[model samples]
Target: MTTWMHPEIGDWEARGRRVAASGPTLGDVDVFVVDAPARTSEELEPLVVVHGFPTSSFDFAHLVDQLSDRRRVVLVDLPGFGLSDKPDAPYRVAGSADAVASVCDQLGLRRFALLSHDMGDTVVGELLARQLDGDWDVDVTRRVVTNGSIYIEMAHLTDGQLMLLSMPDERAARGPGPELLAASLVATLAPAHADVDMSAHAELQCHLGGDRLLPRIIRYIEERRADEARFTGAIEAHPSDLHVVWGPEDPIAVAAMADRLVAARPDATLTWIEGAGHYPQLEEPRSYLEALRAAIG
Candidate 1:
């Protein structure tokens, strides 16, 4: 429940734009929400972005300003992540999609575009399926963008990712302390990028100490594995305009997965960003933003 109103975030808030939290009550969980409006009257179509595991809406902090001016950008922290409540239950990809669709319903959003990354891509695929099946009553616009994560051929997981997937009690047994674990989680995102400084490390520590960390990671892993079938099903049912963007340097998801994704959705385009690692949005913001602009437009 800690809200960082730093100068950087404050500047965006000062733009006379609006940001409000809407709790889309989905069963027992309440998904955390943030929405920013378009600057112009004609550019108000809502665009929703979902963050992956270990990260929250905070992941989109760097890109939100740019997108908010042109569209009502919605960033959500799925259950067990960010400022959301972590219920004592199994987390599945379909559950995450249901929560997202609930958020869309609460916001009264119709005909929206989706941008998802890492684990979020899995959730996006599930949500797409629900829409296609007429289970979720939201009109998803044809534009969809997925970056840095594809589950179709993701057969391998990095050591750090594996470690996170290990049971929380097992992770607790490793004894790195909450601070170290959080630092490690952030480190895994970009090993080649500049080292996370002490202050950043402290911030991560606080984030991990929050009640949401362990459950979020656990649910993220569990849901990812459980929803494999649904994910592929969604790909098979994907509309023609879907786009996949990946970082060529990402070790977790190799370029080969892109081939599988493209093969499944022959109409989808795959763009690989050079010199970027797993978190291309953070590692290569300009390039990521350019690619996103093209994909969404």
Candidate 2:
């Protein structure tokens, strides 16, 4: 594994000055927490955000700042991804969810609203299951936003993703070089907008480190496939108080997927953001933030 200087990571660390950098154990995993101080009364509940695969809490940098001003915002870098310590164990969705709950407990948050995107949605589903199954006492006040994940069938995953599932070690050998990983991350966006330089962000450099831990990361992803039946079952059993805000042009989680989520949770509201792709939060921050505020309110 090669270590390279990632200015993006540095910038994110600096921006997260309000966030205490430390590892807290959650069910044997040392999970990393990036928190913005509570602007509201401590008596008020906090809003916890979870990022999906291949990305970290850094995904919520902008939203966290906005939300933190009015509410306590907690973002977590799931084990093995970000600055969190990666252990030599299999990573599963249930484990990830439990880890999230553990973080909430350690932080003394009694109840929270959830915001998740991409693979984080899967973890969120598991968290809901834990709540329903009586493993955790956390109350999910509301579900604010979702993005280029959910409805697993809709993932327009690349050949590399499918290949990763098949050959973990070989894929890891490909190396998640900063430039290669940065380019792969950039490809997820629409090409028309020159203003959106996804690569210019420092957080991208930190997450591209997945290239080095590709095998373990692939194992974590493939584990989700096995849990699909269970995850789907859980989603069906305990329907979410969800609000879906998706980019219609998203190649990964299409509008139809958001439709399916709405269909599953009929009470939930789904909105399609026009002319945006996978990363709506990054692609359309203003619109996304507006939709989020409305959803949570």
Candidate 3:
């Protein structure tokens, strides 16, 4: 097993632990978890953050400190992504939601705010659905939906993404290596963020031979396409106050999706980070955090 050596990755791994999450059909799998406590003595609803596809909990490494300063923040690297174990099994949006629920159960979190991105948004939708169906007991005080195709139809699928979707839904003997994956991720960023070094994130993506699981992990997109109502519908129906924070320059999950989301739910608020793209939290952390904090506040 080859490990990627990067200072940031090392620091992030040190802050989290690998736990055996046994939830519904997902079975027992090792999931990476990070629980950062609040800095102040006050108690606020903990923030549970779910990362997007091809990445892990490390996506929020930049904002964890500030986010935790106000209230506890929890994150997880779901199976087949980040520092977690990558099983050669089919991945489903429901299973991902199960893993998240198991982690929250293990941590004893009854009430928490949700913050999700990309594919994580779908996972959040499932969680919300479970909550609505009375299958999950946790209370979602609020939610923040970042750059993701919550409205999959409105998204502009990149060529690489389209190609991935066309391939067999099984682990490839070989796949786009870390560098190529890194470049692909960087391509989604706004032009102004061209200088960002996404190498470390890509390195983590390749950790534990995860690079080869692209075909399998990317299956989540198919699930999204097949059943938007099951996932996206939960997001729309959940009574929690919705805050849509987006990067206007995102080419995939374009800005119009945000407008459509607010249209569906008139009570939901929309805030755009001007110069950022898909990964707004990474492209403009300060402004993103400001908008996030304001929304959750």
Candidate 4:
């Protein structure tokens, strides 16, 4: 099937692409899986990656290529984001995880390393809970958590995020449009990196809802608050090894979040990228790649 995919994501040569089922009631969307060049006899576990808010698989365009040479990496454009089907429904974060699971099932993936960033971190937590409960079909051998607003109370939310989370219909109806989203995305990066442009990616993301998806997408913030116990508890009680790589300069997912993660998961490894912002993978790709490699190493 000719599945949906954003042209600007620069993954035209992705190993494979397909539209997979998201959930019982939720619909289907495009899922991309890329295979690294086979190298060693001892192959590592394939990695099932989940992306976070406002953006799509495009957010990991560079990082995906960087890691693809080591092991297979799976990327999906969650519903209502990226080049997937925008069904004008509430874009719940947990639903994104479900979509990833469906994608995994399609690939016959049973045991793989799980890595997530931003809102995707929450999705990973949900998968962790399911794995612990023996409900999921696959095994999450290891997990990686990057910068995210896990502890919402401690996060210093961006004006655009706060704006979207407020006033519901009115804000999304007439709130920050594509321009603001582009600006907000740029602002979330390290100021020192002026050459890192996010407009191309941000513009495509803004097209997901024509300024209407913000209200629907903002439902994730509510989920983070309401499902805190289930998500965080699962994170703390997670059986396999857990790794956290944070961008300390991020105003939203700040140092406090990294600190809190370590406090809860004392055994988890934590790596801090000092000058990077919210999107550390983009702001500091080298450091992000190093930390990520170490996680699955």
User: Best candidate, TM-score-wise?
Assistant: 3
Off by over 4 Å in 2: 1-8, 14-27, 40-44, 169-171, 193-195, 200-209, 236-240
Window of ten residues with lowest summed lDDT in model 4: 33-42
TM-score between candidate 2 and the true structure: 0.85
Model 4 TM-score, all chains together: 0.89
Task: Report how far residue 70 has shifted in candidate 1, in Å.
Answer: 1.8
lDDT of 3: 0.90
Worst 10 residues of 3 by lDDT: 1-10
For candidate 1, the TM-score is 0.81
Tens digit of per-residue lDDT, candidate 1, span 1-297:
345423343342333222232323346565567777786653656788987765566667778778876788888777666555555555666667777877787678877888887778888878877777877777776555444345634645667566556645322423344456556555544466545332232243244353334533445556556667776567556663777777766667666777777887788877777777667777777888888888875
* TM-score to native of every candidate shown: 0.81, 0.85, 0.97, 0.89
lDDT of 4 at 203: 62
Cα misplacement distance, residue 83 of candidate 3 (Å):
0.5
Residue 94 local lDDT, model 3: 75
Least lDDT summed over 10 consecutive residues: which range in candidate 2?
17-26
Collision count of model 4:
0
**lDDT of the structure predicted as candidate 2:** 0.66
Q: How far is candidate 2 from the true structure (C-alpha RMSD, Å)?
A: 3.8
Report the C-alpha lDDT of model 3 over 119-233, residue by residue, as the tens digit.
9999999999989999999889999999999888888999988887888888888878888999999999999998888888889888867888888888888888898998989
